[model samples]
Target chain A: MAPTPLAVSIAATIASLVLLFGVLELVRRRRLREKYALLWILTAVVLLILSVWRGAVSGIATALGVSYGPTVLFAVGALFILVVLLHYSTVISALTDRTVVLAQKVASLEQRIDELERGQDSES
Target chain B: MAKRCLAIIPAFNEAGAVGDVIRAIQRERPDVDVAVIDDGSRDATAKVAREAGAIVLQLPFNLGIGGAVQTGYKYAWDNGYDIAIQVDADGQHPPSEMSKVIDPVASGEADMVIGTRFREEGGFKSSAVRRIGIAMFAWLVSTIIREKVTDTTSGFRAVNRKGIALFESDYPQDYPEVETQALAHKHGLRLMEVPVQMEERQAGESSIKLWGSFYYVVKVTLALVIGLFRKPIPLPEEGGH
Candidate 1:
């Protein structure tokens, strides 16, 4: 037997609520940065809205010429995951670049400090 | 005006060989100042290099070969060095051959001088697989830049003040040795290579292992091809600094 529309909606609603609470709890415990948490919160909110409105998912799927409504939920979930993954990768790339620059700066500063100390020793 | 030359050695976990490399440069080219960029090595690379009388720049974390070398270039540029020579800290590059590579840049005949081991006279030879990969890169680079590039993978190079200024701001951070030549060419820098003797690495395993060589070729080739379509990096405007 196929999963009933009511059961699907309830499952989506529960999943959305779990994600929203999980994200908020992570932010509250300082396990996640506010910037990153914001993205998850937005995702959870959108998923929550689609689950609670019940007809919104079917309406969007029908409008897009998709025959099945549940497929839309799966599609949106997959798209959301892809987007979040891309976002994290971009963030990682940026952090790597900054860390390199920081390392270079720290190294140069240490060298300068050493030179200054040597100069002082010689002068004394 | 006499040229102030700096030998920039980027070392990562090269504690076993870094000190000897620094001392060798001192012994061979006493006129040149030695600066070692310790690329966040967990080993004693910084201490050994400093004890050997070379100035050490201790990076807080590892930035691989490219970032480490770029850091050296930035140091050379900021410190007002007239010529910057790159020497591998693993002892593959002979310190005695530095003047040979540096002479072209010093005389203003070339903005960048690469020390090539692929020449008929150079005694050093890499594994057959590596040589093939190097040849392929050399061919690709030569075709695009319209200049014969013998050793695109050579890390031993000397760059004049102008070249230093260019690399200080923009340098590739991944597998940079081959791509940097193309970058130099794109920015209108004259490039030439001279025959230089090399020895087997004294210590520390090669960064690109046998298994990783395939990945290196693929990744670097893709980067070079992609770079061809990208707009050339603009030179810093004069009097902007």
Candidate 2:
């Protein structure tokens, strides 16, 4: 009743190929620098290997002292979120500073205009 | 004869202590032209400044400190003032020590003079939060401008023609110390540091609260980085010589 060996092999081959294609796309789009692209490709390969070979994952989990369940996935997801949030905070802070400075510049210009108007009025 | 000096006091809702700041600066440097930028204060700050013999530039709406200071710089640059000093509206910056920053710029020694509390006798500010923020900002400023700046965010300072031109064109609005230094360095203006004493606020709560100060530091750091890489904003309609 189990799926044939050919079907499992075909699915694994397709998933791994997709992972490699994604890594290549990131590099081609210049979203990942060449030097960093190598690291990303390596990571994708490791993930593919772990998914295809159950023995590799169990060995990794045992070595790392983590239960081979949702725990490892959850930990990785949380780390990714934390990193993304930190990056976002940095970007937002920079944007706010620019806004504040720009606003100030606008305000100063307005003040100067007002002063000039008042000067002209007084002279006339 | 001593060089002509202009002290720009940028104020916003600082009616309580701005008068005293203007009066003290006048007492110290009677020859220095004092201009009070009343940044849409919903108080008698403008009247008080005028009554104290300071030329008042009343903004129709709140432009905050950066706007007020920029207005002063533009006036100084256009009107042929030899030196322009930025004195805070709050009484935190001592008027007596105004000479520390002004004299350097006036003597042709420095294009800009930053009053460095870091170099003061007490070493550095004691506020734990402020200290951490200052250190991080100092590092960031150094990285951005590729120059060493001990106190990256001190407000009380002085500038001459070179500085006047740069800041009159692109002064930062909120928490501007670090950004100002970055801009100055970018423009190849000479910057010097002088030891000057600062006093705690004399009256009224500081507009910069604890959390606000934290946010200010974080925001300013990012602004500096982005500003360095981003294209500058075009000068506003009121830009002048």
lDDT of each: 0.85, 0.74
- Top candidate by lDDT: 1
Task: Determine which window of 10 residues in candidate 2 chain B has minimal summed lDDT.
Answer: B230-239
TM-score of 2: 0.64
TM-score of each: 0.70, 0.64
Badly placed stretches (over 4 Å) of model 2 are A1-124, B123-125, B230-240
After superposition, the stretches of candidate 1 with alpha carbons farther than 4 Å from their true spots are: A1-124, B237-241
Model 1: lDDT of residue A67: 80
Candidate with the greatest DockQ versus the true structure: 1
Standalone chain B TM-score for every prediction:
0.95, 0.90
iRMSD, all candidates: 15.7, 13.9
